[model samples]
Target: MRIRFKLDGQDVEVDVKHTDTLLKVLKDRIGVGSVHFGCGEGSCGACMVLINGRLRYSCLTLAGYVDGKEVTTVAALARDGELTEIQRAFLENDAAQCGYCTPGMILTAKVLLEKNPSPSDEELFDALAGNLCRCTGYIPIINAIKSVSRR
Candidate 1:
């Protein structure tokens, strides 16, 4: 089957099998290496992506489910070779460590910031609760979200 969707601001059409998870199609067929597969069961949130502006675990989502939808990965958060404010904040606040979960975390934060802009600490935590970072312990990650929210 052929699936068509918008990826990182570009329209993309790729071949997919019925059982293909979004993560599989992305990393294998689409060559999007940033969508890591930590826990394919979706509990780890490592394969998170924005489908039509909603954060979803790509590992749990089928490629066929996203046809004609807008898919945004961590790679899409940059513009003209410049990082988005969320990305910059993550870097400045040392939110990423080991860099394994950074992509999903950043993309999740991006959706949260876009929707709330000035989310409270509780709201921020709730938004990022799904993304687990075993390396950073989430202190710096929460701070990074706060930093971007202020801007």
Candidate 2:
């Protein structure tokens, strides 16, 4: 099937098979390198992306699902080679280890901060619960998110 959607504010039109996962379409066909493929079972948030402003795991999402939606990734978080505040925080706090999960973590934190600029510890932790990071012990990751937090 032929589909068109907005990716990182850019129009993307590609032909995809119904059996193709969005993750494959993005990373393979579309050449988006940031959205990693970890657990194909949706247990890991490594393939997470914002579909129409809401988070969705690309690995579990069919390519047809995002036919007309807007998809946002960590790549979109930066503009003109300048990192977003969250990205800066992640770097400043040394949050990334292997960097495999940084994209998803940053995306999650971005959404959380967007919804609740001043999220409490519980809220912050809860938002990050879905995204798993095997490295960094999560301390620096949490601190990175909190660094740019308004509350």
Candidate number of the best TM-score: 2
What tens digits encode model 1's per-residue C-alpha lDDT throughout 22-131?
99999888789778989899787889998988899999999999999999888877888999888999889998888989999998888887788999888988888888
The per-prediction CA RMSD against the true structure, in angstroms, equals 1.5, 1.1
Tell me the TM-score of each prediction against the true structure.
0.93, 0.95
- Name the 10 consecutive residues with the lowest summed lDDT in model 2: 128-137
For candidate 1, which ten residues in a row score worst on lDDT? 142-151
Expressed as tens digits, the lDDT of each residue in 1-151 for candidate 2 is 9999999999999999989999999988988988999998888799999999898899999999999899998888888999999999999999999999999999999999999999999999999988888874599999999989996
